[model samples]
Target chain A: MNTELVLFGVFAVMTLVSAGLVITARSPINSAMALVSTFFFLAGIYVLLWAHTVAVMQVLVYAGAIMVLFLFVIMLLNLGEAAHRGRPTVTRILGGASAFGLLAVLAVTLGRTQALPAQMSAEVQGKFGTMAAIGESIFTTWLLPFEAVSLLLLVAMVGAVVVAKSRI
Target chain B: MVPITYYLLLAAALFCMGMFGVLVRTNALVVFMCVELMLNAVNLTFLAFARMHGALGGGPNAVFGVGHVSAFFVIAVAAAEAAIGLAIVIAVFRSRGSVNVDDIRTMKH
Candidate 1:
């Protein structure tokens, strides 16, 4: 068996299972912990996709920063085990059906793609998805968007503080 | 080498799970986590496509493909979204004393 395919299967299976746990865990803290594992597994999948920088970001920004934030909020809220973790509600049953339907549609649509992976030389593959390559692209081709995102982050920081505070 | 279709299918499955969580989960924070999962799925799709077509143009130079760049932007946006979303959740919990979606049905309370 191909090593890459094997690795992909492992990462993909782990990611989906953890994500399932994230949604199904009884407490919000359990869900948050499961989400962290899901992020870590997704980072593994990102590596398989040759996204080294993104994989690192997935671990750092997602598993590290964002998840910590989630944990802090969960603890602050002091949420306990869900009181109504009972039989599936009508809305939940409908949600599962629609989600499954969406999966089927997406599978059919992606199945029809006749395109194949573009072959790249060893050197190009090395350069592709690197921090340097992505940075160069962001600085030149996507400069405006990069700057806009920086601004958005700043605004979001201020907005979050303002909104989270008890009063104006 | 693994097929790009495999990655795409995995991403699609992940997206579906996230959608299901967002739709069915009642806890506001869990719903927010589901949104993050969906964003990550899209990022995976972007990288898979990048692997598929990153070297279309000028060989080595074309390594700076749109796919990676798009994923980078998505990650940044997701960070911003998380910050704002969590703040809103905290604010809502403070006011309502509960984070349950059913309890948070009113805007004025």
Candidate 2:
């Protein structure tokens, strides 16, 4: 088998297993930890797809920074008691059913779509998924979206601070 | 010995599973993790498309290049998103004394 297929298999198994643990694990903290591994495996899959930059960012941002913050909250909240109760409500059941419906739709779509396009050309491969190219696009073609995202993030930051500081 | 399709399908399955986790689990932290899984799913789609579009040189690179560049930008944005999202989650958890979605629904009225 080709290297791409082999690497993809490894990452795929890793992702699925970690994702399973994210749900099945009893401890909320353990679930968070399992998610970190899921992110790592996902990064591997990205690498196999030749998206080197995304893979690096996946490991650095999601697994590293995000998971750390999640752990911080879990620890600070000390949610052992609340987590044990496991919120069992009608809304949760409805939400779960909707999520399952979405899965069914996606499966049907995938099954119906055949004859996907093949891999990319040679010169593009030579470009080396560099930061420079990405920067250029972000500043040029995707400039508006980039700026909008920045503004959104700033607003989110301010909102977080305000919410956290509100009189309880 | 698996094919790339297998990987893609697996990613899709994991993504859906995570989505289910987000919807079913009332904990804000678990939902956040599920969102991360969704982002990872998009990352897989990006890479697959990048590979499928063929190399990044010649006319294609000069004209419509969606392979690696889009993927990289997406990852950066995902980072920023996670930072902001986690901060918000923290804020909400602090105010409500609980991260359970159902229990924290004061704004619904």
Q: Which candidate is the best by lDDT?
A: 1
For model 1, the interface Cα RMSD in angstroms equals 1.7
Give lDDT tens digits, candidate 1, residues A1-168: 989878988988999999999989989899999999999998898887788889998898999989999999988888989888535778879988999999999999988875557788787777878898888878877789899999999999999999999978
TM-score of 2: 0.83
Model 1 scores a TM of: 0.94
lDDT value for model 2: 0.69
A1-168 in candidate 2: lDDT tens per residue? 787667777777888899989876767798888998988888787766556776787788778877887888788778663446556678778877877787787777766655343454465455545566556656777678778777776776676566556464
Candidate 1 lDDT for residue A131 = 90
Per-residue error (Å), model 1, residue B31: 0.3
Candidate 1 lDDT score at position B10: 90
Q: Over the stretch B5-108, how does candidate 1's per-residue lDDT look in tens digits?
A: 88899999999999999988888999999999999999999999888886776533434677888888898899999999999999988888888887765665
List model 1's recovered fraction of native interface contacts, to 2 decimals.
0.71
TM-score of chain B of each: 0.91, 0.81
iRMS for all predictions? Answer: 1.7, 3.2
Model 2 misses residue A124 by how many Å?
A: 1.8
CAPRI-style docking class of model 2 based on DockQ: acceptable
Instruction: Give the residue spans of candidate 1 off by over 4 A.
Output: A86-90, B58-63, B107-109
Best by TM-score: 1
Q: Report, in order, each candidate's fnat.
A: 0.71, 0.43
